[model samples]
Target chain A: MVLQAAIEKWSGKIAEVTIGAANAAGVIKVGGQETLPFLFSEGKIPNAPRVAFEVWDVHPEDWPPELAAAWGENLKDPFAWAEACVNKYQAQALCLRLQGAHPDYGNRSAADEAKLAAGLAQKFGLPMIVIGCGDNELDNAMLPAVSEALNGRQCLIGSAAQDNYKTLTAACLADGHSIIAESPIDINIAKQLNILISDMGLPLERIVIDPTTGALGYGLEYAYSIMERARLAALSGDKTVASPFICFVGHEVWKTKEAKVSPEQGVIWEAMTAAALLQAGADILVMRHPAAIEKVKQHIENLMGK
Target chain B: MFIIGELINGMYSNIAAAIKEKDKAAIQKCALEQIKCGADALDINCGPASKQPVVDIQWLVEAVREVTDKTLCLDSSKPQVIESGLKAAGSGSIINSTTADPEKLGLLIPLAKKYNAGLIGLTISAKGIPQNRDQRLELAATIVSACADQDFSTENLYLDPIVMPVNVAQTQMRDILESIREFKIISEPSPKTVVGLSNVSQGTSARNLINRTFLTMAVAFGLDAAILDPLDKDLVDALITAELILNKNIYCDSYLEAYRRK
Candidate 1:
């Protein structure tokens, strides 16, 4: 007797989202899969997961010694940092986080941040992901400026939460950029935010879900389960939850005590978090450490059997 | 829910006139309108007025095919009419129904298999509609067994617990709902379930209200598909909300508009 494997096929597909302008060196496209990640035999997994190096506009005083040493003085300038990431580090994309705009952290003007964004995008033609300072008020004030500066560039600008999404949604809609919808590790909020942003007339294809990452050993399972559930719901034909996922691997992983123990452990910690999320259906991983990104990139290639 | 639009049938005056005159424009228009309103498929019925159901069903299938590639459900009691529609439909169509009676099953199942179309099996026999859920289940099992014996995929089979009018069979409503949930357990990777939704509101004064409410309840009971009027926006809205509450559809602020667009 011959045995047949039961392959699970999905009725829905994850919406494919392109993150850069066509005129750029290259645009990064993610999520057009009809099945769960890496189940190539069951269905088509058209694109491999992408990795973006996280660049900060201001020199970071909070980053631990090992992480800070990886980029040395390049962290002091956004241009040097972005250039190194593109040319030296072989980075596929760059996520420029305007952490300097926070009141306590330099409180840089929106015009300055916008100039930095447009400059980096021009200097390095890779797909850009611009994120604002974590403060809601400050982000609202700053991201719109950045959105206009990068008009027609099609960068992935973030973080429209449930409480404050309209301004960023409207800006992204006008500026021709995609958005990252943030939920505090809650699937319902994640889906709800996607809906709210979409209601503003921004198509679902231009939105990526940020379910809010949690480091390994620090609520990783909770984040993993939420993402897994959301991906399954999407695959089962729920159009509202069908957008691609963007995981901030570096933001979550480097903050852990385990990462601070040793340099190799820190790299492993970040890489492991990303690897787990790739299995949980991460389309774009915003990471910090070059070593960790390399490790995860190799893992992705292996999983994709390239 | 897989909603099969019930508007293309000859029972409606517009469709009746279109069929009578072989007006392809009217039929195509109806097909496009239902699809725009979010119907997963359209049910093509010749109704009682058609003297030549065979030709009418074929013409209807061709007209609908010209407008959209959405699935068409060829609905008829006679196998020849269904076969004609199936021949015109090509593939990915559905056989609107066959009774649990082996004789009807014997003819329809092969036609369904040959055309690569889905089949809806009504859990009723020569005796008439089942009086209770158990009778419905028994007939469902018979249909499942028949499909299995004929080497037809059960996944392509949809078992319908014929919904009776609320005014006439009020007590049977609960039985019909229960039978829908039970039909899944009778077979592994269970066959899908459907209901001819308008039947429940057949003589009711509040037609739209009753239709939407029952459709919502049926959705909760795991009804997979329905032969329904997609043009009834309120009823469609209610159905979308029911699926949203059940977590089948993810919630959005403009979910009604979103569902229709989807």
Candidate 2:
């Protein structure tokens, strides 16, 4: 018998999203696959998956020793740290985590963090993803100011959840920036949040979905499966869950005990987590270890068959 | 859904008058309006009313070609009338039907291959319509096998199980739906499925309701094409909603508009 190819003739496609300005120095595009990722011979895969280095506005107190030592004293200053990542580590993009602005963590006000984001964007001039502290009230307060700070630059700002998407949606619309719509690793919630955000009149092209994932020893399978399903649904033509996926690989990786305490294993743990996410159809990976980012980039290039 | 806009048929008095008068503007308006209302293709039929269906179909095809390059379904049981329309159909033409009757298939199957047009084969024969799923399946397999033997691609063939009026053949409705699902298994690449949707609601008060509801049920069974009134907003809405429920389309607040815009 002549063997036949078991290719899927899918009628739907994941939404291809542009994260940075058309004229930006380092613009990134993802998620225009007609088939599942990296099935190059089966369908069209336009843009390759990418890696985004995560930075922070305030000093990260609980970082793994390996990560802490890698950045050294630059972690204290957001601008210097972001500059070092691009100039040294070849980070395609940077995600500025404003964890310190939470009411519990030093209570730095929204305007102060917005100032830090503005300064970092001007200094680094690379595509930046500014994320809030996951505090609903504080995120509602801070993200609007940051959205205003990077109005013309087409940067990615996030995360609007089920209860708190209106403010972030309004801010992104007013400032002309992309948004990261985060769902708690549930496909339905992920789809619903996208519907809610797009309902506010933000075009689907500027939205990236964060179907929140976990580290390797953690709930990795749950996150992995959700991301995979979202990608499949998108390719199968569900517009509500069709935006490009963005996973915070570094934040989830560094928070794990393996990355923090396992000596030699800690270094490889971050890479393993990121590798799993990339396989799960993550368009952009936010990771900590420089080696992991480099290794994942190489792996991504291979997976894309570039 | 492969909607074949059923407006330009001469069965409609307006279209009949337009066809009789050779009013290209009226026929062109019908074509443009149906295309605007989300018709994937248009069915050109001179109907029983036209004294000269062959001439009318040729003229109607030319009129529609003026406004858009969308696909034309040259709908007729007669091979000569379909052949006349095919001459004027610039491209993207599909032969509307051939019954499993050997004489009809012998005439239309070659036209389908000669024009390289997509074909719809009714699971019907000279002996009359299939009364149940087995009868429909038997006829459908015969049609598929005949197309295969004729070197016509089965993938381009659409099988219509010939929907009967619900008021008369109520029990046959489920069997019709079942045949639509089973027809795919008869070939390697699987022939597509279609229905002359409004036939189910003939002689009924709730024509639109029955048409949309049955159409929805058929969609759940993997219906690929339909020939009905694209102007029926409720019927189109039911189709779009059915596709969304089936996870075939992405949900947007303006999904109704989005589906039409596509």
Candidate 3:
């Protein structure tokens, strides 16, 4: 009951993390930490789970048709679409996916992605996260411009891999942006990338880790274990691993058949898929369905009871 | 590299009493002592001593700001206290935390944004305190991501990996070692990584003695800043020694100069 009580109390408060400049915009800070991840009462949760609405640079061709369908007319304009995610869905942050920059996607050049990102920055005053195509080289090229274009605003720039960190890290340093260093779900790799970034002489506080989440039935367990291990490392005073963790919850959820397909596929599939990922360790989820985000938030709140 | 003296926190009785009585002398004494000893900043925590912590904190922040231009580390869980302190500070200050709680993120990040203040983000989140380096790393990622959401400047954010007592958690040092090592890699362009040097030795005998050694080891592992006693010669020396060994300081000249000044 004590653990239960603690969990309930802790759930009410969301954790905070500040990146980018200590004094600049785009600083993400989680304020209340009532308990350990999911453990309530040990700490306090003062904020609600913040949401980030997703948008893409170009029309997504490979996405599950259902996801593409959700965006409908909004997909044509990144700015309007971003506004919809925030204004309509009450998203606190915006996730601008440079899907077009992908070689296999729309095949847009890095410069094109950067220019689009710049436009989004001009359009939205709220904090935004710019995710690059998975191509390391293109990400390296595109992120720097995005960082510069959003200078002083403190945007989050990503798809920064170990191999391509130098370019992106330099951009962040020059432009005052925070970054997410992603790694395959291996704990060691996650730690290694964190070290690499700092060793390049950047500060540890600016970087967050994306352990690479999987759909509920896909590799959620692995993501859970990776995240759990990373958090443990931070508490034990590993300043490097102590930055914070991020989950691509929406990306994973939308990709899953349960979330993407209709009830004819399986009546319980949608609920089951969303619930499973929430259990696994999703700090900041980027979701497509407003209802799904609400469902996950409610489940999290009910479980936390805070 | 701004080391905010953390002696004013409520966890200490003398400081709490001073804050309660509105004793400027006591507060001034602590402030001057740390500054004279080499602190770049003084963290003023009002504790839970008043019915309205924000008002009391405002008074204290003004009091401390009146004496020094050194930046302040505003430590309080309440946003109002932080806001009051920020308003009263003579210079930009560091938000003691936006912890890893999801809800608090919105409240704390905006303050950092509004005031153009530096921040300290704790690694522990809503889940609870992590027990090992891996979990700490996960929290570190969460902290950075949350900051990213707010658009906080990466250069200004400092991450405080929660440090438990090694006496209770023997592997804490190892955890810190691994976490810092990992944190450095994950943090792009390295955000400031700091720790409360005192936490490692709490409840242990020969605290200062233990603290010095731990501080040295932590600094070696990329600890950029420490919330500690500027007057502690041994601890200060240990940090200098670490800098020299790490070749962080071009020569032992800076170290010698510090020693000579003392």
DockQ per candidate, 2 decimals: 0.45, 0.23, 0.02
Better of 2 and 3 by DockQ: 2
Candidate fnat values, all: 0.40, 0.05, 0.00
Error of 2 at A268 (Å): 2.2
- Per-prediction TM-score: 0.91, 0.87, 0.51
What shift in Å separates residue B183 of candidate 1 from its native position after superposition? 3.0
Report the C-alpha displacement of residue A20, candidate 1, in angstroms.
2.9
Overall lDDT per candidate, in order of appearance: 0.91, 0.86, 0.70
lDDT of 2: 0.86
lDDT at position B189, candidate 3: 60
lDDT of 2 at B253: 55
Clashes of 2: 2
Cα lDDT of candidate 1 equals 0.91
Cα lDDT tens digits, model 2, A93-174, are 8888999898666688888988888887777677889899988988898899988988888888989888889999999999
Model 3 lDDT at residue A138 = 71
Chain A only TM-scores, each candidate in turn: 0.98, 0.96, 0.83
Show pairs that collide, candidate 1: none
True lDDT of residue B35, candidate 1: 92
How far is A9's C-alpha from truth in model 2 (Å)?
A: 2.8
Docking class of 3: incorrect
